[model samples]
Target: MRKITAGVFISLDGVVEAPDQWHFPYFSDEMGAAVDATLGAADTVLFGRKTYDSFAGAWPEREAAGEEDAGFAKKLGDARKIVVSTRKLEFTWRNSEQLQGDFVEAVTALKNEPGGNIALSGSISVVRQLLAAGLLDELQLLVHPIAVRKGMRLFDEGDTAVPLRLLSSETFQTGVLNLIYAPAEPAADAGYEDAKAHLPQS
Candidate 1:
């Protein structure tokens, strides 16, 4: 099965939204390389309506303008773009399509199809849904050093806990951390007696 990897630029306090306001000062060559690696592995891109709108508004324009990021913009424009939304959308972007029907069923079917990794970026709602459905294979976070103190976070208050195991991590020179994780089986619950042996002796 093709792996589904979700990559997000997160703040130190777990904020994931509006990275443009707080993320660029910390961007470095290392971070660029890390992002390039993820995009390099995936031939398809997944987006929620919000992210799709944001990207569709910008990338094509950037590519057309021949900006510094024009190559990356071109890559995104060339990739198969799948937007997950309940409302009908007119996709003017090339190679773009809307994902219809049941969200989980449709995405599960997409996962089973033979293809390269399906990469998702900047789509917080979609990521949560994928995590809840157990459909996400990897969660790659580039944790920046600063905190905006107020924004939509990756996980909200009273959300159900989802256990994840760190697959790997790397520290960039700019104090950013690239953390890769995968869903993990819940740890067995244990009472005080289970840890008594490891307690400090007086």
Candidate 2:
């Protein structure tokens, strides 16, 4: 089965919203390479309606205008784009389509089919749903050093705790962390007895 991976630009405080407001200051060649690697590994891209709208509104025009990042825009344009949405959408971009049927069932079916990896970016809700459903294979976070202090967070209150194992980590030149994680089995709870050994002796 193909893997479903998610990448996000997040602040130290876990804010994942409006990265364009604070993300560029920390961009470096190292960070760019990390992002490129994620994009390079996927043949398909998944998006929530909002993210789809943002990219669809920009990338096609960027590719047509032959902007400096036109190559990247073209790459996105050429990929298979799947948008998760309830309302109907007119997809003007090539190879783009709205997800049909139930979200989990549809995505599971896509994973079971023969294909390269599926990549998701900037879709906080979609990522959360996938993680909750145990369908996300990996989560790649480009964690910036600053704390936005107020915005949408990657993990919210009342969310069921999902255990994750650190698969890999890299510190970029700008102090941003490239952290990769995979879903993990729930760890056994630690009680006072488990911590007693490290308690200070009077």
Candidate 3:
């Protein structure tokens, strides 16, 4: 079974939306290499409707222009793209498909199929759903130093706290932190009981 991994660029304040406005200052060869490695590891790309539309608008043009990262853009263009959307939209990108069914069920089926890992990028709502459904296997956050202060955050208010175990972390020269995490297993009953005992009685 392939693992479903989400790779996102976030600010110190947890803002994940519109990283392009602030992320470039922190870009470096190391960070670029890391992005390439992550993309290289995935045979499939997943996106929500908004993200799908955004990428479809931009990456194809970049690929055509032979811009820097054009090779990576080609890789993305060639990969199997599954967009979770109910609204009808023409998919002109090669190998792109629309997924209008139950998100968890559809993604679960994809995970069970034999293939390389799946990569998810720039879909906060979809990522939240995946986390809520316990469908995400790993999360990679490229944390930048600056705080955007006002934007859509990765974890919004009223969101449940999902336990995560740190798999690894690396710091780039540009002050970008690559933090990798996996969902932590549920605590044992005894361990939970022990922690509960320390809480104040009402």
Which lDDT values do the candidates have, in the order given? 0.91, 0.93, 0.88
How do the residues 51-107 of candidate 3 rate in per-residue lDDT, one tens digit apiece? Answer: 998999998988999978788889999899999887876789998998767888899
Candidate with the larger lDDT of 1 and 2: 2
The pairs that clash in candidate 1 are none
Candidate 1 local lDDT, 75-159, one digit each (tens)? 8998999999888999898999999799999999999999888999979999999999999999999999998899999987665
Q: What is the TM-score of each candidate against the true structure?
A: 0.94, 0.95, 0.89
Task: State which candidate, 2 or 3, has the greater TM-score.
Answer: 2
Report the Cα lDDT for candidate 2: 0.93
Candidate with top lDDT is: 2
Those runs of model 1 whose alpha carbons end farther than 4 Å from true positions after fitting are 191-193, 199-202
Higher-ranked by TM-score: 1 or 2: 2
Per-candidate alpha-carbon RMSD to the true structure = 1.6, 1.6, 4.3
Scored against the true structure, residue 102 in model 2 reaches a CA lDDT of 94
